[model samples]
Target: MKTITTAVAALFALSTAVAADEVCMNASEMQSSLIDWYGERPVEGPSANNTRLWVSDATGSWTLVRTTDEGKACVAAQGRNWNASMDASDVLSEIAENTES
Candidate 1:
């Protein structure tokens, strides 16, 4: 789990350094896409400007999304092996550490 988290964090950090291919849509459409296509549902929300975490227990897949002031939702990060028992703050701290390195 820690390895997956670190890998995800590293990927996310590298993604930020490069030009991201962000897909944006109206909040409704984004929600439907996550549910229908990925079977992910919102489990966390409104952090740092309307950010939310969606997870699919069936597949252990997860996605982080953020909504803009215009109400458009965009995918920020996505990966697998999402453990509901894990603390979000811990994952975020891992991300911060990975980014710093």
Candidate 2:
């Protein structure tokens, strides 16, 4: 979970960094589109800052979305091959440790 939180944080930063090309809209619309278009559903979060992780079981795809207090939402990041079993904290720690060096 810590790893996911770190990733969510990074994604949020990345979104702000690349705001010019970001696809943003009303939060509800983004939610509906993720489900309708990619079969993704909220699997985790609405974290301390309203970030959420959405994943598609059928497609093995995942997305990170960050919503603002005013109800705007943006796709922070997205990728394929999501595996719940692989979401171990230690694995994430190792990845982060390696990244720092």
TM-score of each model, in listed order: 0.70, 0.65
Q: Compose the digit string of candidate 1's lDDT tens values, residues 23-84.
A: 78999999999999999888766676577878787877777787999989987667675665
In model 1, the runs with Cα more than 4 Å from the true position are 1-19, 92-101
- The digit string of per-residue lDDT tens for model 2 on 7-59 reads 54443333222236877899999999999999998866576657687877687
Q: What is the Å distance of residue 40 in model 2 from its true position?
A: 0.6
Model 2 spans > 4 angstroms off: 1-19, 88-101
lDDT of every predicted structure (CA atoms): 0.69, 0.64
Compared with the true structure, model 2 gives a TM-score of 0.65
lDDT score, candidate 1 = 0.69
Tell me how far the alpha carbon of residue 23 in candidate 1 is from the true structure, in angstroms, after superposition.
Answer: 1.2
Error of 2 at 32 (Å): 0.5
